[model samples]
Every structure is written in structure tokens, then in C-alpha cells.
Target: MRSAVTGTAVILAVGALVTAAMTTATASASPPAGPAKADPPRPVLVDCTWHKNVRPADFILACGDGNSRLIGLHWSQWGPHGATATGVNMVNDCDPYCAAGRFHAYPVTVRLDGPKPWKKDPSVEHYTRMSLTYTGARPDAFKAVMIYPLWD
Candidate 1:
């Protein structure tokens, strides 16, 4: 009887170990937590051709996307050939020329549900023109060539 009980105990222990291993494998094989939020689809540029020396603006813009908060207007002036020109970010409400010569992209986030002209149509339908210039040794004039809106 003693030998029989010991054999049964060993068999039960092995079964428990197998069950635990199977459970772990099943848990790991299952998908992760919740589904990730997919990024918003890109909107077509309806009126981007008319704006000369302006960056191609994005329409489906959001407030807090992985890229930027609001829409950003970028401008740069290169040398004779296709040289690298200084890029500027013109999203601040203050003077556009406040941070001149800084080769950095500026972002301006606007409230879609705020007051004024924006609140009237808070459906991601807004536009603004930004003027920028290169303040380097050889300063070159360039306006916000593109206006990209955020989505998602």
C-alpha cells in the first residue's frame, strides 16, 4: 500500500506540472491586452496647389498626435542648388520672427472648441498663413510652404 500511494503521488505531481506548463503556454500564445488605436486616415489636400512658397499643409489635423500638437508651417531657403537651408517652425501666437535663425520646426496647437472664428466651425476646418525668413549669414526669404494638419 505504501508503494502504491507513493506512485500515485508522483503521477499526480507530474500531471500538475504538465497542466501548469500547458496553462503558461496557452497564456503566452494568446493576444495581448486591448487592441491598439489605429492612426487616423490621411486627408487629401484640396487647396495646397495655390499656396506658393508654402509647405503642403495637412488637413486632417488633431491636437495631440504622436507627431505634433496642431498644424505646423515649415519654411526654408537653400543656396543656388538644392542645398540644405535652415528650417523654421511658425506656430507661436507671438511675433513670427521672434525665434529667427533657429533651424527647428515650430508647432501651433489650436483649440477646436474655443471661441472666435475657430469655435464657429470646430470641425477641423481652419487655415492660416505664416511668413518666415532665414536669419543666417545669407538670409533668404521664405514663407510657410506647407501646412500639415494632425490626425489621430
Candidate 2:
């Protein structure tokens, strides 16, 4: 009977010690409660170079031949949904030939929308569509406003 009591007491003591140790460890291991670190800012646009940027001053529309481009971009808004800018659309006439074409600049209002994860870097977002409204004389045969699907 005495041995049984001693064994029970030993077991209870060991259990208490283990419980206290576990409580202390859990308390210490818990993360400190404070303001969480902010996530990195997502980009609104990806230029022809596949580089992410926000409110870029210039962007190329023609990645292959550099025939069309936007310059002097002044962004009015750059939010998660979309971005708006007023710039000049510079395009080559390609009158005689592409190599000898003359470049013309026209006033334009640009809108970037449909942001999606960039394939090259999933952590970053890039605009999937670009809409341009010509505020002045536009390129020949081109409409007053045009929408183009941006590269992923």
C-alpha cells in the first residue's frame, strides 16, 4: 500500500513538472503581438523589357519592331484596379519602309487594366490590357481609341 502511494505521488510530480515545462515553452515560443510587416507593393505595369514598373515615363507598345510607343506619361491614378495617364503616342509612319519610317507624336490618354500575375515572376502583377484614346491626330488607319492586350 505504501509503495503504491509513493508511485502515484512520483507520477503526479512528474506530470506537474512536464505540464509546467510545456506551458513555459509555449509562452516563450509564441510570437510577439504587434503590427504585421507590410507586403511589398505590387507593380501596375510591365514594360517591353518585362520589367515591372509603376507610372513609367515611357513604355513601348511594339516589342518586336519598336514601331509604336508611349512617352512622357503623367499618371493621374495608379491603383489596384487600374491606372490612368496622359502621354504622347509615338509611332513610325513606315511610309517607304520600316527602317526608313518617320516617327510622329500624338497626344493620348492611356488606361491600363486587367492586372494578373506575371508568368515570369508570379509574385509580381502586370497589366494585361492597355487602352489608348487619341486626344489629337492619330496614326493613319488607326481608330480614335484602341485597346491592346498587354503581354503577360
Candidate 3:
């Protein structure tokens, strides 16, 4: 009898949680609230033409993935295999809409690795991938090194 009662209680608790989650999800179905958003441009490199002296230490890169750009890049090491750079990526909480002005910054170690030929332009080379490993607080975030490809 006690085991049966316990099972019933567990089932009721799970049902309640499921119901609450459903309610929350349904309530947020409306369009996100925030400032007006301009259509995101195609996901291309912020600037494919980057040089050592000309490129700024910090810049805005619109990677049309509807997230955020890599901010505050301070390169400490550079080589053929990869370039180690310290930077900040503002993880945007695009609750409803991507262009919503909700962004949070976190320190990240960037790796521009796997040099490859610029398929279209044979004269130049590009980093096949860019990896980010967060070195700061991770609330609702991950410690994984997420790799993103770079394009001309």
C-alpha cells in the first residue's frame, strides 16, 4: 500500500511540473518585446580583408546566426596552426526576436585554427574554423568549445 501511494505521489508531481512547463511555453508564444530590428545580413565574415596593423582591436561582426559577435579581441599568440586570442562574446538572449537588445558579455578564449585556402580566392588564406571557450561565469551557458566557420 505504501509503495502504491508513493508511486501515485510521484506521478502527480511529474504531471504538475509538465503542466507548469506547458503553461510557460504557451504564454511566451507571442512575438518578443524589444527595439525595432533590421533584417540580418548574410552570414559572412565581418571583414574578410583583415591585416595586422589596420584591423581594430575591437569591432562588430554580424554573424547572421541571430546571436552576438566576438567583442574585445586581444590576440596573445599567432601561428600557422592557430591563433590564440582573448575576447568577449555577448551571448544575446533572443527570447522572442533575435535583434532584441538583451545581451550579456562573457570572457572567451578564441582559436583561429586550421588554415585553409580561400576557396574562391586562391591568393589569400582563411581560418577554416574559429572556436570559443568561455573563461567566465556560465549561467545557462556551456564550457564546450563551440566551433564556427569563417567565410569570405
Candidate 4:
């Protein structure tokens, strides 16, 4: 009688352990509820160049590079009243191909020309120049987003 009781207890214990293990595994294996969302794309860097020149009655800021595959331009006119002008252009180079096998480099240049009174000398015009250099790796899985101040 004692042997029978021990055998039954062992069987019950084994069954319970097996059931618990199966339940835990099934819960874990099931997929999560929500749909998977992909991450946003990243930006890539190409060749670029810029310059600023002060001319009478206006300021000329120019930037460009033959090596860059993609090029963009922007400008703003600062005077008594705030006025702005902007433009973008994409150019593809033939050499030093992009990672995606595209023969294009991103290039950007800007030129701002306008009349503004110098802060120090009200009689003289002030010509201010500014430029930007972007450096980063291109994303493999996502498309790049190129943004410029003039885009807005």
C-alpha cells in the first residue's frame, strides 16, 4: 500500500512539473500584441564647401564643391524688414561611389546678398557670412533626410 502511494505521488509530481513547464513555454513563445514599427531613416554626409564675400550694397556668400554628389543652396535677406530666399539642387558625381552604389555625393552651398547698415557704422553696409559642414555615416536600412534652413 505504501509503495502504491509513493508511486502515485511521484507520477502526480512529474505531471504537475511537466504541465507548468509547458504553460510557461507557451506563454513566452507567443508573439507580442502590437505590430512591429520600423525605426526612422538616418542622414548621410557628402562633400561640401562655402565662402562669404562683402560687396558694396550687398553681401555675397557662396559655397560649392565638385566632389559632392548632392547639392543644396539657401539664402536670407536681413534688412529693416525680414525677407528670405532659398533653393536646392542635387548633383551626382561619377567617382567615389556612395555606399548604396549610387554615384552621388551630397553638396550644399549658399549665397546671401542684401543691403544692411553696419552695427558699428550706420553709414556703411554690413555683410555677414555663415556656412555648415555635415559629417555622418549613411544609414544602411533607411533613406536619408536632407534638410536646409531655407526649406522652411
Candidate 5:
């Protein structure tokens, strides 16, 4: 009768240990707190029509549409590798001259963001967003959102 009690106690102790282990394992398998991470957005490609072989008087971006143009740019630095220029943008401000409109010069700073993708064509490259931090001297009615990359 003593041996039978001892065997039963051992079985009960083993079952208790197994239950504790399973509880610990289940807790450990639970997902972590907070939201899951999402993938970052891809880099947008520069418009194909905006390519330039020669830097314009003002850096001209010949977009696919004839409406948009960067008419004049005086580059302090320019090359096949990279270039930086400061000039006025002769943009078609949908104002008095919608059709044969007068292109006005707005103060601008132009820069080369990185190296040219195409090796054969040295002058062509990418650019960054315009810094319109200008206060009083800034263009009239120029919105921060309206600014885009004037290419290299």
C-alpha cells in the first residue's frame, strides 16, 4: 500500500511539471506588442521628357507636356558628372499669358542629386526638391507643394 501511494504521488508530480512547462511555452509563442512594420515607398523615376543635353539659360525641364519648362539657369557648377546652378525659372503661371504668356524669372537654386544613370550621356543626371525657404523675396503665389525637381 505504501509503494502504491509513492507511485501515485510521482505520477501527480510529473503531470504538474508538464503542465507548468506547457504554460511557459504557450506564453513564449505569443506575438510581440505593437503594430507590424511596413515596407518603404519606392523611389519615383524622373520624367523621361525632362532630359537635357545642354543646360539652358535657365535650366529648362522639357516635360512630356509643352506647358512646363525650366527656361533659364545660370549654373555656377556644371559637368558630365554633376552640376549646380542658380537662375530664374520661366514657368507658365496660368495668369495673363495662358497661351503666348510671358515667362517670368523666379529665384531658384538648382543642384545635382546624384550621378548620371547612363554612362554614355555624361551631362544628364537627377536632381532634388527646390528649397523655397525664401521669405519676403520669394515668388508671388508660389506654393511649397507646386515646386518640383529641375533636372541636371
Candidate 6:
């Protein structure tokens, strides 16, 4: 009777150990209660070609008539809030008329700011304001520094 009692006790102890082991394994394998966090998406620039770009070599300021644009862009800083670049602003002289105008290049420092969700796609962000500070020569009717609103 004593041996029988000892055997039953050992069985119960082993069962308890097995149950504890399973509980621990199940807990470790299970996923977290809440949804997993995802990293923030990287911002992009929507160019005149209607494509997303990062540090584009050229960007068009005048999408309608293509009278103004930026070329040879060398971006020094591009972040979530803003971007800074050094480039040349090429504008049409429009001497006789726009169709027969000569394009001129001016050294410029470009700053892109006012980050907002793009109109076409809310998930994507784009710069809404662009500032141009002419370092050397400038356009005929323009100032040394100018700011323009970018299109979505």
C-alpha cells in the first residue's frame, strides 16, 4: 500500500511538470496581443513626370509650359520636414515670345518644405513649397529670391 501511494504521487508530480513545460512553451510561441508596429514610410518627391523620386537630378518648376526648371540638383539634405539642394534654375528669356525664347541658367540654392500628403495618394508625402535663392544671375522679371507653391 505504501509503494502504491508513492507511485501515484510520482505520476501526479510528472504530470504537473509536463503541464508547466507545455504552458511555458505555448506562451513563448504565441504572438503578442496587440498589432505589431510597422516602421514609418520614407517620403518621396512627385516629379513633373508624375512619378515618385528621391534626389532627382532634374525637376520641372513649370509643368504647364515648361518655361522654368531646375537642373544638376545636388541635394545636401533630405529629411521628413524639408530638403536642401544646390542647382541651376533654367528659365526661358521669352525675348520675342515664349515659343522663340532663349533659356538661361542661374545658380540657385533650393529649399523644399511644407510637407503634406499628396493629393493623388494620401499615403505618400510631397513638398508643397519651394524656395529659390539665386546666387549669381537671375531671371529678367524675377527677384534674387523667390518662393513658389508646388503642385501635387
Report lDDT per candidate.
0.36, 0.91, 0.65, 0.38, 0.52, 0.90
Question: Who is ahead in TM-score, 1 or 6?
Answer: 6
The candidate that wins on lDDT is 2
| Cα misplacement distance, residue 33 of candidate 4 (Å) | 3.5
Estimate, for each residue in 1-152, the C-alpha lDDT of model 3 and write its tens digit.
99999999999999999999999998799677888897532122235344322123664444456366777788886655667778887777776776665887878888776766556655555566778887866427565567777664
Q: Rank the candidates by lDDT, best first.
A: 2, 6, 3, 5, 4, 1
Q: Rank by TM-score, highest first.
A: 2, 6, 3, 5, 1, 4
Candidate achieving the largest TM-score: 2
- Estimated TM-score for each candidate: 0.25, 0.73, 0.56, 0.22, 0.41, 0.72
Which ten contiguous residues of candidate 1 have the minimum total lDDT?
Answer: 109-118
Q: Can you tell me which runs of candidate 4 are displaced by over 4 Å?
A: 34-152
lDDT per residue, candidate 4, 56-133, as tens digits?
Answer: 122212134232322233435434323233333233332356333343233333333233554444554433322323
Which parts of model 6 are misplaced by more than 4 Å? Answer: 1-39
- Go through the candidates in order and give the C-alpha RMSD of each one to the true structure: 15.0, 9.6, 23.1, 20.2, 14.7, 6.2
Model 1 off-target regions past 4 Å? 35-152
- In model 5, the Cα lDDT at residue 145 comes to 26
Off by over 4 Å in 5: 1-58, 79-82, 119-152
> Where in model 3 is the C-alpha error above 4 Å?
1-56, 59-62, 139-143
In every candidate, how many clashes are there? 14, 0, 0, 5, 8, 0
lDDT tens digits, residues 1-152, model 5?
99999999999999999999999999889986778787532222244454434444643354554444454556576554455666655556656656766555566665553443433344334434433322224446766324455443
| TM value for model 2 | 0.73
- Residue 13 C-alpha lDDT in model 4: 100
- Give stretches of model 2 more than 4 Å off: 1-40
